[model samples]
Target: MKRRHFIGAAVASAAALGAPMLRAQGRPRVVVVGGGAGGATVARYLAKDSAGALDVVLVEPNVVYSSCFFSNLTLADLRSPESLEHGYDRLGAFGITLVHDRATGVDRARREVTLGAGGVLAYDKLVLAPGIDFVPGSVTGWSEADDEIFPHAYRGGAQVALLRAQLGAMRPGGTFALVAPPNPYRCPPGPYERVSMVACLLSRINPTAKVLVLDPKPSFSKQALFEDGWARHYPGVVEWIGPDAGGAAVEVRPGVGEIVVAGAVLRVDVANIIPAQKAGAIADAAGLTEGGWVPVEPLALATKADPAVHVLGDAAAQGDMPKSGFSANSQAKVVANAIRAELTGSRAFPPRYANTCWSAIAPGDGVKVGATYSAGEGKIAAGAGFISQAGEAAELRAATYAESFAWYDAISEDIFG
Candidate 1:
């Protein structure tokens, strides 16, 4: 039942079971591992588009999915955590099989997936959308084991709730320290957006409090937009340190609630340590990873190691796309089309992908960065990018914020339904 027992168990299982499991009812079966934005969208699409021609099975350990996309809003009291939770009951109407179990391993040779619940699923096509997992020791003196004292709140659900509770209990005039991760992590602008939201929360209740951002990178997504917003709204409240100022040199002591930046120790009331990340363990279990991510062909998102297995979302190392939910949902459509074309002989069209990441800096104030993508030069290449500019009109910013709300509703429906 161990999730990491991949190669040895898969090889033994393949040897014992000489023939691949027959497709259910003689229809091509697509097994999607992970039920986040990418998996749910692709699953719903395949079932809806194929019209019962293909059997779609989605394997996810959780019955309810809490999105990390807007969890920051919860911290600022703009949204409640319960509002972010979505159940899978709606997907049942599509005739997709929902397996509430963790995918332990993938047997590429036999085309079977091992589940933690002691079951196996055979698939003609396998999709990995497991998202990101933290890299061990990426942040010195901080680890997942110490997350209780210093919550990362990177993933949705309990962790976010914990961080929110800690923030709520923070003393007046306290310091909130955030350790941002490196490039190629999920939601490039997420940590910064969280900082903005936190500042908004504290500005009302704890005006004397401080927000510290320790970033390993020199600059981040939507840097100008965020910096300008911070200065205008939360002046003298947020301080950001980049790599040149030893932002990269960080160490935390959860026991004492202390963090060392550039060999200087500071005690903080709350610390959100977002460490480096990699492809989820399931991708590694399938032996499809390279350089902490799954290398995928641009057109269909198929893994370089095996064409039958496609990687999506944060787990995929496809070029030019920031690891965001919008990007994943966009990639899912392309993957769905390519998968359906191959499995059910459906008409395939040229793949076109798009993504827009929106960040709410303050109440009714939002900024965004996005791009369109297409397959080129063995990778997903960016084209026609757009971003929110500094010094925008308040009405436009409010409209942009309203647009993000609509997008959240639309995309959630598109994913869970």
Candidate 2:
């Protein structure tokens, strides 16, 4: 509907009690933690759409955010590392107060947030999109302390660069191993897409180098399509071992650079160990999480613990939607509209969400899976969906790959600007 037209209303209704300094500002404030995909989009939308009706502040420790979605291509040398990096300066243009500090705690009773830099922000509404943190002891004989030896380049930025350097320095014909995480993690097709990208690079540089994928699950998203692409592009160089073949039980030896699988030891030159993950630590500290993820009402992503506190992206346990950047961005728009209507007497439209995860199997070869969602009684329910087929034409795959680049650019602008 004509939701973009904001009707003028009394601004006093949106104000919430806070410290004298905050109250003196005389406007409703929205404090968004974690300036990644969801936080950035919500903050930008709230401030931009409100037309100076609300005071919005975004709290992020890092000045530049690197997207995890396209970092795989960077590892494969298809995308430049700088292309993934984005600054929050543009977000400031929308009059959003950018707080470059980590959110240490949330005082839900008083509606205040403590910052790592010795300050506090009081807000009318709070949005937490802190993404993910690794779950401790999920993998045997390995921890974040060993990340230097066995890097998990799951997040974008320097970790991906480090893994790329290690790959380049590996001895010809050496083995590159990947330990995929279990289910309910961010990006279902992420680990598998990474394997394909690594294979793409190794096949060109080190033809004899082996690419090994040890997955804990019996199958993964688009398994048939990935298998088909691997068989055609990098046959005899890629191997996938699922739980049926003892892939679930594995141990890493950082000292000796070896992996023990099903009581058998295999030496490897490079290892990418992806351990289990949970909501960001801030979610736990705030006491908003149940079972490591913040449970939220699907209508507006409002946390069950506190309706004023909304959680989004990987940190939230909303049903049906996969934890991808696209999902987060979609959820953010719904949240922004809901919050604006609550705080500014703006229009409230029915919430609708959608997500699409596109994976580049090889150079100019891509596949995708996507779905539309609606809020159900107790959870978000998936509606119609689509997935790439096993025997797609070469032209379609290439177009899919090209479509991914355009999506990246469009989403980047949508989030930052």
Candidate 3:
């Protein structure tokens, strides 16, 4: 099939069947908050799969979504940030209402969502996929205001462009320092992959430059694979300090461009600080968060706080699933299927989830880790998984990088067309 026609054909086929005779009198409404991977996929799937039976609405603050999945490539100059931007016109074409506004509050008792622009939307089913918000004061001397000097760029968009500019402006032979977040944050391997990209860029423009990573966690996702790739691809250019080595005991002075690690001070030319994150503010307002994240039933992804409200993506504390775009996309499908079955009396199958996280170590070097999951004891548990091994051939790594690009295009089409 031609790539251009894929989304139109899918929507046309679903509409052709017409909506299954709705079980309820009026059309049920499903309001999705956030328009990233999880929310967008659920909103699109719910509307597309149900045809006209469900009134699907998506609330997003931005018209264009800059994906964090491949924003690292922008830093490496392998891809442009503009290329990562996606619009919602495709969702609108599928008959889903797109509301360009921030979701400020969720009135669970009234079953409505309050928008920043002063409107309330009532929903029979509400899916909160609001992604993550940084925990205030999680990183010392760093706030949203400091982002201009020390770019986190974890959420992509403008922060990514800022970080890219900082990298470009760095002095030759200078130091670039990164503070990686602990576990349970979005994209477990993101910080490491970012380090690789930074090294790749610095190696070309400033071969004498150094890249330092201070990670709060003792171990990281794809640790061995990334370490091996760093050694072979950009030897002696990168260094990592784990928690055992006082990585967790670090503070930054963005004004002075200085970092204190384990009581020792080091001056750096650039700093990227990724702090602890929690569910979006609306999730907390709705009482969906317990330990900084929303807990959900594995099978339906309905929030434990309120079954009428489903949570997906980084905001969801689904055990064993890394908080990556791919994970959110996978979880959205399961939630959409469950919601469809409930609203239309359609057949519902046991939920099965799958995710693959691909990290580009350099221009032609990529590694991946993925798993298939199933519901067990109220949590999503990993069943089988694969990880790139050490000492793989260069051709295989190149193929893996190509696969990541293909997956990005395919998934973006599936979500936004």
Q: Which candidate wins on lDDT?
A: 1
Candidate with better lDDT, 1 vs 3: 1
Clashing pairs for model 3 are none
The estimated TM-scores of all candidates read 0.95, 0.94, 0.94
Per-residue CA lDDT of model 3 for 140-217, tens digit only, reads 889989999998999989998999888898998999999999778999999999999999999998899999999888
Per-residue lDDT of candidate 1, residues 237-282 (tens digit): 9999999988998989999999999989999999999999999999
Question: Which stretches in model 2 have alpha-carbon errors above 4 Å?
Answer: 1-21
Model 1 — TM-score against the truth? 0.95
Cα-lDDT of candidate 3: 0.88
Q: What is the total number of backbone clashes in candidate 2? A: 0
lDDT of every predicted structure (CA atoms): 0.90, 0.89, 0.88
